[model samples]
Target: MISKDEVKHIAALARIGLDEKEIEKFSTDLSSILDWIEQLKEADIENVEPISHITGMENITREDKAEDFENKDGIKKMFPEEKDGYDKVKSVL
Candidate 1:
């Protein structure tokens, strides 16, 4: 179990203000957390494998394909506003 002095030291390190009741509550909470960690240490993980992720994925590479078009005028016509054959937006700054 956590001690009163340890709780006070932790509060000071964290720059927190704690009254007697808060200190006692924190001490109990920290003890419970530590107990949980101790229990987890007893888990059986001897045959378990370390993995970055569980899902399987294929790393397939593909050649880049390019298709040329002459739709500049069509694109400009769909724009909200166009000036000098180019789309225009509100200026920043």
Candidate 2:
């Protein structure tokens, strides 16, 4: 079972501020979660096969193919400010 002090410690570590009510509630909730996990540990699944995904889906990605832009010069002309061959913007730092 999770104690109130343990819950408070967890809240502090996570940088979450919890009131008295919240601390009490979390203590019970955390204990219940641990109990549920313990119950699951007793289940037998020796014959079960591990699966990556429930829905079988294959990678449908297209091959990477580099192609030159048709209107490269035209697009460059649309930029507000251009220095050499690249766009010039305000300093960020």
Candidate 3:
């Protein structure tokens, strides 16, 4: 069983704030998840072959072709703000 302290430590590492109720709920949830994983570990799969993907689809790729940009000035003019040949947007941080 997962302890409340372990859940609190995990929340601290993830930098998320959880109340007392949430911490207790997550402790049970995480304990159940760990139990399920342990059951999966006990499964016998020695004869099973490892598969990368269930869908039998091969890698489909197109030939890389360079296309000339005919409307460079027109595209640049569409931007609301441009500075030093680059688009200037608001700072995210």
The best candidate by TM-score is 3
Per-prediction TM-score, please?
0.44, 0.45, 0.46
lDDT of each: 0.89, 0.94, 0.93
Q: Residue-wise lDDT of candidate 2 within 1-93, one digit each (tens)?
A: 999999999999999999999999999999999998898777898998979997888796987999999999999998899999798999989
Candidate 3 per-residue lDDT, tens place, 1-93, comes to 999999999999999999999999999999999988897777799999988998978998988998989999999898899998788999989
Q: Which stretches of candidate 3 lie over 4 Å from their true place?
A: 44-93
Query: 2 or 3: which has the higher TM-score?
Result: 3
| Candidate 2's TM-score | 0.45
Cα RMSD (Å) per model?
13.1, 9.5, 6.6
Superposed on all Cα atoms, model 2 deviates from the true structure by an RMSD in Å of 9.5
Model 3 steric clash pairs: none
- Taking the tens digit of each residue's C-alpha lDDT, what string does model 1 give over 1-93? 999899999999999999999999999999999988898778898998867766856576787887777886787899898898877889977
RMSD (CA, angstroms), candidate 3: 6.6
For every model shown, the clashing-pair count is 0, 0, 0
> Model 1 segments beyond 4 Å from truth?
43-93
In model 3, how many backbone clashes occur? 0
lDDT for position 50 in model 2: 74
